[model samples]
Target: MRRLAVLLLTAFTAALTLTSTAGAHWHPKPTTAAWQWQLQGKIDLAIEADVYEVDGFEVPAKTVSALHRKGRRAICYLDVGSWESYRPDADRFPESVLGRAYAGYPDERWLDIRRIDILAPILRSRFDRCRRKGFDAIEPDNIAGYENKTGFPLTAPDQLRFNRWVAREVHRRGMAVALKNDPEQVGQLVGRFDFAIVEECFAYEECGKFSPFVGAGKAVFVAEYSEPLAAICDQAERLRFSVIHKDYDLFARPWEPCFP
Candidate 1:
């Protein structure tokens, strides 16, 4: 019995070690990297992008595997801070956690981020699916709910705690996570998140707020909808941001890379 106990203890220790080391999977935080963000139409595989950010639930595992075969990384796009009515797991969210309707998005509603106990398990399940699909990183959207009218009386500290928990959960699953469009909290979050994804930063004149990410050797992926590439490419080049002119719909076409 003593010998058997020793063997089980050794196995348990090794299992724990493996789980801890999983977060050590190194994801490079390049200042500039070619990337594609397509969430609406069929994915175009010939975009010549180094990274592909796609909807986590809609995309198949085989697609992520294919990106890996092509020497490209895949970032799983999941809305951690909102509940989309169209999602497969939409019904899992209780009414209490649903807040105001997401501005401009008819099918989405902001989540009561203060309910971490209720939200963490659901978010973890989403993260697990992404991991199983072989995504190298995650793009968690709507993280800056406090800055918006989420109808939950959310404070900045509440947002920080939720965001940090998100980072920790994603890292624990061995995938890098991006801080999506939360420029105000970048200073506090840059050290935790591996990269960032922002939309119309140049148009909003908030591009400079993300300099901390570049300074920390982290990539900042920006998508400009109204601004022409010619107008922002110079500043993008100077800032070392991976900027692209993408339509708000996020189809494969209308993609104009600043670096290209």
Candidate 2:
């Protein structure tokens, strides 16, 4: 009886530790969140923001550590729905899963999200890299490929399945994941993703579609390339979104935040 009691106590302790660790993942709230997104040029750590979203591969682990040292959360950016020819793992992607070139970006091709078996391993390896680099979260870009001209006959359901898998994988790594620019799936994915990172929603007047995240108290980070702050700032403030006016290249400068 004494030995059995000791084993039970050990199991219970292990369960508690696992639960606490899982619950420790960062979930940024809209009220207190401010963010910077710079995927080009040297990362400007001098930017005053609570969060910095930078390229997972280009930015070193030391940069992530530096953000943490400044009491800021770091979000790792990686293309999940598209394949870039420039990436180090470019050869790992099988040709069978490659589709039409991403419009405007000739070097990037849309990935067949339906082929999860082939993609899962590659993405898992990338996610593992992000986790090992000490990033607090992930910004999986190009997630709404179904709505695009991707050669695959991908339906809404296919995108949902793929996006959910992304969130689950990121969560398993004990990091937050963003739902990038999939306004149509916002209702279904808001609960699954920790936050929403969108581009040009104001330009398209589709900003309202992301209200579900804000309504759920999750941060909604918006990056507008052309629209001036005067044109969207009022509505952005009302929606409680963290809006930024950035250059198309997404360099560290030309950084304009609505709340800042």
Candidate 3:
């Protein structure tokens, strides 16, 4: 019995070691990568993009497989901070945890991320679904609920704790994760996340805030709705940001790349 116990202990130690070193495996963050962000309608794979960020549950597995076949990477788009009523798992979120409706998105409500104990499992299932769909990474959306009228008195520390946990969970599932729209915590989160997705950072003149991510040699993907490709391409190129000029609808056509 003593010998068997020793063997089990050794195995446990090795397992723990593996877990510690799991996400340390360096993934070369793309240099001005060509990326496409499309969330609605059938994902048209014909676009000239190296990375495709699409809806996790809506995108078909075969589409991911096809992207893989074409030597493209896929990032699963999952909403971690806000709960969407239209999602299949919408019923899983209790009414108590649901906060005010997401600004501009009436169907979506902000989630009280302080309740990570309840949120983590649901998020894990979503990550697993992404894994099964062959996603190479994750773009967890709306994680910066602390900056919004989330109906919960969420603090910056709370957001940081939740964002770090989210990144670790994604790493645990053997996938890279992005810091989405949480520019305020970039210095704290740049090391934790593999990359970042910023919406209208240039328009808001907040593009400079992501310097930590760029400084850490991680990719910073920028998307602008109204800016023409010419207005931003030169600046994006100088900053080493992979940018795109797309409409609010995020349709297949007119995915204008601004990578320099």
What lDDT does each candidate get? 0.90, 0.92, 0.87
Query: Which residue runs does candidate 2 get wrong by more than 4 Å?
Result: 1-19
State which candidate has the highest lDDT: 2
* Residue 94 miss distance in model 3 (angstroms): 0.7
**lDDT, residue 5, candidate 1:** 100
Question: What residue pairs are clashing in model 1?
Answer: none
Could you give candidate 3's per-residue lDDT for residues 1-260 as a string of tens digits?
99999999999998887687555533536467678999988889888888889999999999999998999888999999999999999999888789999989999999999999899889889988998887888899999899999999999999999999988888877788898988889888898998889998888889899978888888888889977777888888878888988888887766888752
- Candidate achieving the largest TM-score: 1
Question: Residue by residue across 1-260, what tens digits does model 2's lDDT show?
Answer: 99999999999998788667657899988842457999999989999888899999999999999999999999999999999999999999999999999989999999999999999999999999999999999999999998999999999999999999999889878899999998988999999999999999999999999999988989999999989889888888889999988899889988888876
What is the alpha-carbon lDDT for the whole of candidate 1? 0.90
Task: Supply candidate 1's per-residue lDDT for 222.
Answer: 94
TM-score of each candidate? 0.94, 0.92, 0.93
- For candidate 2, the lDDT comes to 0.92
What's each prediction's clash count? 0, 0, 0
Off by over 4 Å in 1: 1-20
After aligning candidate 3 to the native by TM-score, how far in Å is the CA of 143 from where it should be? Answer: 0.7
